[model samples]
Target: MKALVIDDSRVMRKIVGGILVDAGFEVVEAENGQDALDRMAEHDDIGLCCIDWNMPIMTGFEFVVEVRKHAEWRDVTLMMVTTEGEQDQIVRALAAGAHEYVIKPFTPEVILDKLQFLGLVEIEETV
Candidate 1:
């Protein structure tokens, strides 16, 4: 699977990318929502996008709204991985068309489970 992980923290991005890679996925990085959108626009092979709530250039909510407006990218599974634990923020993200939500301090197991549940990661046979 191919995933685009959008976050402001370099550490967070690397951590998430490592998790995805371990799960047998090719991951791409974006510093912010705008960068994510630009990457998405250029790569149609992207099957999933993991976004962060707060960003400098463009917020994740704004990016979600923008992506939701386009028909082509509607089928992409959008998941938010951030510290925005407020109920209203979760509601807004869901309303804007996010498929899954994962709060910060998440374990790699949590991320893997969500990806599997969302049909983003294909389970491979062990040797």
Candidate 2:
């Protein structure tokens, strides 16, 4: 599956991208929300998007709102990978149509498990 990782931090982006890649997903990188939107416009194969809450040019919340407004992108699973741990932030993200949330300082296992919960990750045989 194609997954988009949106974050301003190059390190964080690489980390998340690696996790998704290890999970058997084809990864796409976006520096921020606007960049993510541009990618979405060009790629209809994007099945999942992992966006950071705080970003320049456009915030994750704003991106979520914009994506939710469009019918064509409605089937794409949206996930917020952010440092915002407030209950309000969680509620707001869910209300804005995010499929899942993962706070920062997260491990690859946590992200993998969450993706499994969302049914975005396929079960693979162990070697």
Candidate 3:
């Protein structure tokens, strides 16, 4: 499946994208929420989005709200991957339509685990 990695930091985008790529997803990138929206519009097959909370042009919360307003995006899973670890912010994102949340400085394992929980990925049993 395709995944969109959205963050203001180029390095963060690369890190998230690399993780998704390793997990067998075709990854697309966006520098911020507006760019993400544009990319999503262009790619109808995107199944997942990893969004950062704060961004220029549009914030991740705004992005989630905008996406949830459209029935076409209903099947797309939204995951917030950001430095905002406060409980209220987490609650807000979930209420706004994020399916999962991951704080920054997370390992690839954490991301993969969340994706698996969301059913966006199948976990391979390790020997």
Candidate 4:
């Protein structure tokens, strides 16, 4: 599967992209919501999106709303990976069509677990 990692922080994008890549996903990095939309236009195979809440051009919430408006992108799973940890913020994102929510400062395992929960990845048991 293909995953888009959207964040204003280049380091954060790299970290998230690397984790997704390690989990067998082809990764694409976007600086913000607008960039993500642009990438999506170019790549119809994007199945997942990891978005940041706060960004310059467009907020993650806006992105979710825009994506949900398009039937063509309905199958794309949206995950918010941001520092906005408030309960209301989480609720808002979910209400806005985000499939999963993960606060910033998360470990790769957290992301992997969420992806597994979303059925975007299969979890393997260790011997």
lDDT of 3: 0.94
lDDT agreement of model 2 with the native: 0.93
Give me the candidate number with maximum lDDT: 3
lDDT of 3 at 49: 97
Indicate the TM-score of model 2. Answer: 0.95
> Candidate 4, which segments miss by more than 4 Å at Cα?
none
Q: Point out the higher-scoring one by lDDT: 1 or 4.
A: 4
Lowest lDDT block of 10, candidate 1: 118-127
Question: Number of clashes in model 3?
Answer: 0
Q: Residue 16 of model 4: what lDDT? A: 92
lDDT of 1 at 6: 95
Q: For model 2, where is the 10-residue window of minimal lDDT? A: 118-127
What clash count does candidate 2 reach? Answer: 0
Per-model lDDT: 0.91, 0.93, 0.94, 0.94
Off by over 4 Å in 2: 123-127
TM-score against native, each model: 0.93, 0.95, 0.97, 0.97
The sequence of per-residue lDDT tens digits that candidate 2 reaches over residues 54-90 is 9999999999999999999999999999999999999
Which rank order by lDDT, best down to worst? 3, 4, 2, 1
Deviation in angstroms for 110 in model 4? 0.2
Which candidate order results from sorting by TM-score in descending order? Answer: 4, 3, 2, 1
Cα TM-score of candidate 4: 0.97
